[model samples]
Target: MSVRELIVLGSASAVPTKTRNHNGYLLRWDGHGLLFDPGEGTQRQMTHAGVTASDLTWLCVTHFHGDHCLGVPGIVQRIARDGVAHRVDAAYPESGTVYWRRLRHAAAFHDTEVIREQPVSGEATRLDTGDAPFTLTARRLDHYVEAYGYRLEEPDGVTMLPAELAARGVRGPLVRRLQEDGAVTAPDGRTVTLEECSVRRPGQKVAFVMDTGLCPAVYELADGADLLIIESTFLDEDEPLALERKHLTAGQAAAAAAAGGVRHLVLTHLSERYGDADEERFLRQAAARFSGEITLVHDLDRVPVPRRRAVVRPRPAE
Candidate 1:
């Protein structure tokens, strides 16, 4: 079976607490694995989470903050050490190119050429990964420093209806031909169209928003996403501080998820001040605004993307 889930390697915000590590999240979507915001200690965290450098196909950095990008050197060196042959594309705000370069080669030990740098710029940009399973887009966010949010959207497809195919006596190779050509002549000489035997299936979407305050781009990135991994660095009581530091409160993150029609909201990047005891308060604050599913993540937690919404087509007039 195809696996789709978010593995939380580390979930601390600015500092590492006794329980939480710095920000690090790995999104596993079928054949693709995207590592986001690898903060300090992410290399060891990956081992705890049972993920290897080979599992990473893409590396995404929301910003160049020490708590967000400090793990880049270790992860990059590990990739080279492990001899990961597959191309690993890394994307971040173009404004942070200097920081990225410094971190990527901080202490190179036998470097590998498999890592590709694909820095993003502008208000909203579509990344070119060339024939990827989903379309990857980046949008600017409201933060003290330059930051970007990422969205992965799969293309819509048709789900074949076995009943419809059986009714038309279309079996085996004929079904494949109909799907490929949109229409095929059955053995009975009747032409059957793909539309007559399939239902529209909306593709799933996953959004990653980190280190950003309330902004229009946040909503755009989270729009209609099946899963949204966003930072909730503060509770409602600390809204002023959150705004000052360009971070989201739990309520704000949940409100954005609700506005964007996100199905599952995985909240992480919590401030170190809020210990394990304050976790429930975060959930309460978020639940008050967003009725959808919400999760207050911890290190090594796995969050599965919600199942696709069912598409109900209205029958034609009788």
Candidate 2:
């Protein structure tokens, strides 16, 4: 079975608390594993979460904040130490090239050439990931510093209906041929079209929005996403502070998710000021706006992407 989930390594915002570390998230989508953020203690946190350097296929940094990129050096060195041969694409804001370079080579043990620097520039850019299963796009966000949000979208395809195929007398190799060729000669000497036997299946989508305030890009990234992992750094009471710091309050994040039609909202990057007791407040604030499934994550929590929406098509007139 194909696995799709998000593993939370750390969920703290600017400061690390006794329970929460800094920001780190690993999104597992089929064959690809995207490591997002990777703050101070991410290396050790990965061990606790049972994630190795070899599991990472992409390193996505939303911005150059220390709490978001400080662990890049350790992760990079670990990749070299573990001798991970596969190419690891690192995507970050192009304006933060200096910060990225310094963190990438902070204390190199044996520099590995496997890491590919794919910087994000312009307002919105589609990343070239070379035959990746999904299309990855980055868009600029509203933040104090230069920041970007990422969205992964799979191409829309069709789901073969066994009943429809059986009715058309299309079986075995004919099914494959019909799917590939869009039409095939059925065993009954009739032409069966692919559209007649399949229903349109909208592809799954996952969005990552971190360290950004309310912005149009945030809505674009989260639009129609099956899973939306976004930062909810403050509660509604601290809206002023959140606005001043260019961070989203729980209500704002949930409003974005509601407007974007996100199915699963995994909120993280919480401020250290709020302890374990304040978690419910975050959930309440978000619940007031978004009716979808919401999760205020903790360190080492795993959130699965919601199952795909079903597409129903009526049978053609006989």
Error of 2 at 65 (Å): 0.4
Report the CA-based lDDT of candidate 2 relative to the real structure: 0.93
lDDT by residue for model 2 over 1-318, one digit each (tens)? 788999999999999999999999999988799999999999999999999999999999999999999999999999999999999999999999999999988983989999999999989989997998899999999998999999999888899999989998999999999989999998779999998999999999999999987989999999999999999999999999999999999999999999999999999999988889999999999999999999999899999988877588876599
What TM-score would you give candidate 1 relative to the actual structure? 0.97
lDDT of each: 0.93, 0.93
Q: Which stretches of candidate 2 lie over 4 Å from their true place?
A: 315-318
Taking all chains together, each candidate's TM-score versus the true structure is: 0.97, 0.98
Please estimate how well model 1 matches the true structure, expressed as its whole-model Cα lDDT: 0.93
Clashes of each: 0, 0
Poorly placed runs, candidate 1 (over 4 Å): none
